[model samples]
Target: MGAASLVALLRYSDWHSWLGYMQQPYLWRVVRFSLWQALLSSGISLLIAIPVASCLIHRSFYGRAALLQLFSVSMVVPTIVAILGLVVVYGRSGWLYQLFDIHIPLYGLVGILLAHVFFNMPLAVRLLLQGYDLIPSGQWRQASQLGFSRWTAFRWIEWHYLKKVLPGAFVLIFMLCFSSFAVVLSLGGGPKFSTLEVAIYQALRFDFDLNKASFLALLQVSICTLFAVVVYRIAPVNRQDVSLLAVKRYSLKDSFWAKSADALALLVAFILVIPPFLAIFDPVFSPIFLLTLQSAALWKAVLVSLQIAFPAALVSLLLGVSFCVLARFCMARRYLALLPNKIEHLGNLILMVPGLVIATGLFLFLRDLGWGFQSSYWIVVWVNAVMALPFVLRALMPVMYQQERRFRAVYLSLGVRSWSRWCLEWPLIRLSVAQALGYALLLSLGDMGVIALFGSQGLVSLPLYLFQLIGAYRLEEGACVAVVLILLCLLLFYGSTRFIGGRSLVKH
Candidate 1:
């Protein structure tokens, strides 16, 4: 990665090109808008999340778990599908226009902000909810005995921990919004709302300007590194505790105002996430649906998507498990010290290197090497794998380490070595492994970043095909494709999670 960064830097080191590009007012506008929108998106997401999280912890109602699951889905719901869903509701001739006769300017900054909030606010709510779990039950008991009002309890008890979580959550959502691509591309409408990621893609794919692409990638890396450092330093980890169910404050009676506020916040979150998803299903009944299904191009794109997803997922799982094993081995010795921690951190550090930046670097390098589109296939896979690595490690590292810690001596004493050891361990951790792999597969399948830059007519994946369909305003066809993509994501996600991991022995 360092070598790629340096190579990108050196290739774009010509001061004249830098000065000329920097002189363009449009570039500065993009930079400023990127920062401004990210700030707004993060700030807005947190503002909304705080109340929602509070309501959730204050009261556990029916469907709350499902709502939390839905929140998790927002983060991984295939960007193009989410964008298409958004367009269905907020576009000029969409749901609002047809039903209410309201036309939102859904093609520009407004749409961009809507899309960012739709994708990110639920994530903020989930993260903030975790912060609530960190609060001790004793505090709630004290509040109950003292007859604390909702506001008073929140001010004195909950706010204390929630504030600790705010900085990390804000930075994370900001980084996601800053590097956003699919939303910007679909709804940005034009250069007025483009982000750095979009600008980098334009330079590489449309303009074919290697120097410009490299320069943008370098800038992106520098900014991302600053935020990544903050993330590392803050290191907020909000784990669930069983005590979250304890000591519901008896003093906190539901007032009409509190009920109204919680209802509104939850309604806002529900409307934000559900409508777009439901809207995606609109075309399933249309005549174009069957036609799209029969189209060879659609099927071919599906095949191509699988072609990328399978290998990319395998590579991610292999790399993640390998890192966990090595990290655990080092931890066992204790002399190797932070080698384990460093390895764990290095695996996640992939997040700081945005997918497009990595692709841009690889794209530039491949061009210099005279590599053709044949090898671009592998490059896309490699980039997608790297992009999913952090998630895979997040799923695997804890479970993998725990299995080793609990079972290592037993397995060693019983002479479970090599193949025997792996077989023994496989079932124990396959649930996590399958989940991680499933996530990687979905990520690779849904990716528009690497493939967008490398995509050619001959190399179209499902997402790129759907993107093209949406771009041409073929709503009928795009809806059909969106349904297929969503089904594929869910099917594969569960197939791996349930079938590969086997059903949980724990009775629900």
Candidate 2:
């Protein structure tokens, strides 16, 4: 589907007409806005994440575990819920302005940046902190003994660890910011501040300009693909953890300063995180009528989400598993090893090609393929299954790799075939498989792209249903549905928690 879209795009000659429109002053302005906003959002998120990660690694203060958990809480919150929180907190009649008389605009580039940072910062902090936690405490102590200042210690130890993964982290965050859809579609007040994804959406859904939309989609995909490739190439692939065995210790010198810095970092994290929780919670408890719970349409949407999510999760897991196995086998075949690192690259590439672009591309491709079953439902399900591939890979591959390293010899001696291998290995790696399924469910449940493309009389997922509620000015009902959606996510998260508890059953 994606390949056909690219092929079709290349065949056009009046590239001049499309290129000219792309180069138009307004489009250039939009591109510049998206670029800088993404950069700044990623920067601000990293800033918020780093100090907190540093403090957590260095200091074992009160509620230290809780603080770490706090940092992690935002990692799984749905984007739709996050946006709703932003609306309640910073919107026209939000509590902030009511409490402080400070009216902040929540509908422009600043709002978009805040939302992006909100969604992305926790991921950055967690990733970077994993690096920090891996650095040996001995290195820190040795540096301190050598009269190395805080900056100097960071320069030698933290800097190197951070540098190893920084490009990849930045690239991932940038790709996320670049392809932001729900945030832009909801909070982007006007077309002037739109992104390429939003532009593609507006072109197709609102303006109905097929030629212009297709042109813009091709351009967006090209730019994003190039950036993804460059960033992946620049990122380091191998660097072992140094702090894995580091002994935890309380620092003696300058405890006051460390405490103060830690407190400040906690405060900053608090401000960034607390609002969304409050926003999501406040509406649920507020004397708002719970009409959505009574509506048959809401139940239908829930059922629809379950049907799509279960199959999508299973299918995505299968595709991800296949990709992982293929990559593992390809390691032995020198010629195949020389091919593009598709397994590693495809996820980010998919992210680069925004959901709308993929949906549009898939729609066109399916239309061209002359499939007998041409319902929009199949398109949504297939694209969604593909979209869930990245989450599955991220969750599953690490476990699979670890298992292969630990038990490869045992399995090789037994001459385990494919089905037998799965029977043995799946139990050990069930945690990762479960995590992948949970992530796939959460992601697809919230997605609006596929439904938007092949939208039908009866088709509705939670996000699409939420969109309809919001469109009809049923804010209170929308909030209720949002709460239900969030609870479903929490249920998934809780189920994943069992994997952590059962980790002891699987030997490394």
| Top-TM-score structure, candidate number | 2
Model 2: per-residue lDDT, tens digit, 215-265? Answer: 777777777778777876877763434224334533434456667887898
Tens digit of per-residue lDDT, candidate 1, span 266-306: 88888888899898788889987999999999999999999
Candidate 1 to truth, TM: 0.84
Residue pairs in candidate 2 whose N, alpha carbon or C atoms collide under 3 angstroms: 134-242, 134-243, 135-243
Candidate 2: where are CA atoms >4 Å away? 8-16, 59-73, 130-153, 240-254, 330-342, 371-374, 403-428, 499-508
lDDT of 1: 0.79
Q: Against the unseen true structure, what C-alpha lDDT does each candidate score?
A: 0.79, 0.71
Give per-residue lDDT, candidate 2, residue 202. 80
Give me the displacement of residue 438 in model 2, in angstroms.
2.2
RMSD value for candidate 1: 4.2
RMSD of each: 4.2, 3.8
- Alpha carbon deviation, residue 81, candidate 1 (Å): 1.7
Q: How close is every model to the real structure, measured as TM-score?
A: 0.84, 0.86
